[model samples]
Target: MTTAATTETSAITETAALQDRLDFYWSGRAAEYHAHQVSGARAAIDRELWASVFATALDGCGREGSGALDILDVGTGSGYLASLLADAGHRVTGVDHSPGMVSAAQAAHPDLRVLIGDAHAPGILASSLDAVVNRYVLWTLPDPVAAARAWRTLLRPGGTVVAVDATWFPHGVDPAMKVPSADGEDAFVRTYDPATLGALPLGTAASMEDFAEVFLVAGFTDVIVKPLPQVAELDLRFGVAPGHESRPHFVVTARCP
Candidate 1:
């Protein structure tokens, strides 16, 4: 089992691979994207932006213990994060919509449970989870409010939901960097305006107040929003455009009460 600080270079590289796995439309480009991200230049983008977001979300899950803590990683592409958590002694279940991603994760960590399923489905039931962690998924969902509500239903009273996602596009990169639709219809990407990104479905908007409010409405309490300080190394390397050079996404932790 490896701690955050002790994960090997290969494992870190593996984590980078998983990040590219999130653009569900890019399944064919996985290898290329993975390679583009492994250089030192890209390392900072990951550390400052992505890894920090996961760390913040996991923080709300509390500390590791001898007894196993139950956790679900929604959109658990390649299960690297869940694998790391499990290494630290948590009992983790990872679920993803992509079969390829699920297969990769399960193959990578045979000891952990990886399932092929949609986060929006009833496959996960009410009050059955201790915590739910999602990253880079909110903006992709067509119905963000319903998605949040579903997450709330899956958590037990006092359980935590930790989610992180970017609100802005790459500075010079247009949405075209991503195919408008991957599945023959304009159904894959849910385009959100800046206003929409900050609102209930996509995010709590800019205010920590609004962020907390959504969780409260979803029946959560003690919600906290933490703004991760930018890491220059991360930005220069993995950032798609200049906008990401200055701004990083927010990670929120809210507990179901």
Candidate 2:
């Protein structure tokens, strides 16, 4: 896990700058992204899968929606998950530091609420949310622990926080293939520091343990870890597959104790 270290380049590539870049990146590719929302079928299929995950969490706690469940989607790049929850009757608030991404999300999912804000400081009230969800946004942050702790602060008592992100390390697999050039201005997906992304900074490959510990220390409970495996030829070929190199992605779920 990456520690909350300050970067000098923040002036040039701070969260705000990165957010702007991401916003521009997604806005330009929003159509293509929405088109490929699901591997097969309408974009909503991915939405359904996320809905299932969130519903499972809710169901595990034996709580049905009293009204619309108040949910927050942090780093909600395109607001797909928040839109899904909104469709499922959740009063969803999607936050991303990227305004362009938020705009695109709002444009596509007009019914859902989208906010441009930092996950580290969501501006949402602390201890007032029922659940906070982050999808594929973990690797982008410079400080995963502080970010997670910030999310924890937004949850109400017993509120569940679920984070799903790519947990693959860039092993020297097929290193001969040159990295592809992206079509638009937003080309390279920024990677974390070599240490955090490669081996654990202060620990082993089980570095997620460090991430889990951050939340534990901050006040989350019932932490559950799941590794999603990617095993198809296409998954491997895409290079974005959630395996060990891109297939076996891990997720951590915990409750605000």
Candidate 3:
């Protein structure tokens, strides 16, 4: 084979290997991650706060209250969002890459439909969903732009895509992004190696516009990024986990058109 072809094959092999490593890391971290997420969303009011955010976004497109919207929750770790949306009377299907996470979500909410699927390459039909939603997903994606563009093909015309995430790693995948788990381990530091960190453009993203422009560039229309004030308010009342204080999240809304 030529030099270029050999290089291409090696790159593909490396990427596949990295994804495998990521899957394992997330799987092993599922127990700790679920506990953390569930704790924050333990209160009914906090769950409702997030529900309202989804409601308003769905309402903007005249989807909410019109009927039961079909929503796809990508990277549905522990099924927290799936349960919330299901309780709100929407038809929700959750997709995660790790079997561990899929199991946690299913075990927590037996009735919910949670499948093992990649966040970037979901095995879903085209233009068959009313919305594609994710929480804390974009920051680590190797190709977020490609993922956003793929999501556009999954939503029906006028459907909305909502992403809830914050700049957790303002300093990229360095020691600064490390936070000890309940057991005093930082799984993120282990999972995000040099290649992983290099691939994630949003890891060091410093502004909200950085998140907003992604959807805009992906061919989505009416992209808007706004502070999740409700989340901040709840954080103040409930208290956040260590190292998360003063770190506010934002919601990005982009219309599939």
Which one is best on lDDT?
A: 3
Question: Compared with the true structure, what per-residue lDDT tens digits does model 3 show for residues 1-257?
Answer: 47998999988798778778777777777777777766754467867778888888777553453778899999998898888889988899999988888998999899999999877789899988998998888887777898899899999899999999987767655555555443245666767766577767887788888999999999999999999877777778878764455567899999988
Q: Global lDDT of each model?
A: 0.58, 0.63, 0.82
Candidate closest to the true structure, highest TM-score: 3
Report the C-alpha lDDT of model 2 over 194-225, residue by residue, as the tens digit. Answer: 43233222222334565556567667889877
TM-score-wise, the better of 2 and 3 is 3
Query: CA lDDT of 30 in candidate 3?
Result: 76
Better of 1 and 2 by TM-score: 2
The TM-scores of all predictions, comma-separated, are 0.64, 0.73, 0.89
Q: Is candidate 1 or candidate 3 better by lDDT?
A: 3
Ranking by TM-score: 3, 2, 1
Q: How many backbone clashes are present in model 1?
A: 5
The lDDT, on a scale of 0 to 1, for candidate 3 is 0.82
By lDDT, the better pick of 1 and 2 is 2
TM-score of 1: 0.64
Show the colliding residue pairs in model 1: 41-237, 44-233, 44-234, 45-234, 198-205
lDDT of 1 at 184: 27
Question: Residue 240, candidate 2: how far off, in angstroms?
Answer: 6.2
Runs in model 2 with CA error above 4 Å?
A: 1-31, 38-45, 60-67, 172-186, 189-211, 230-245
Where does candidate 3 have its weakest 10-residue lDDT segment?
175-184
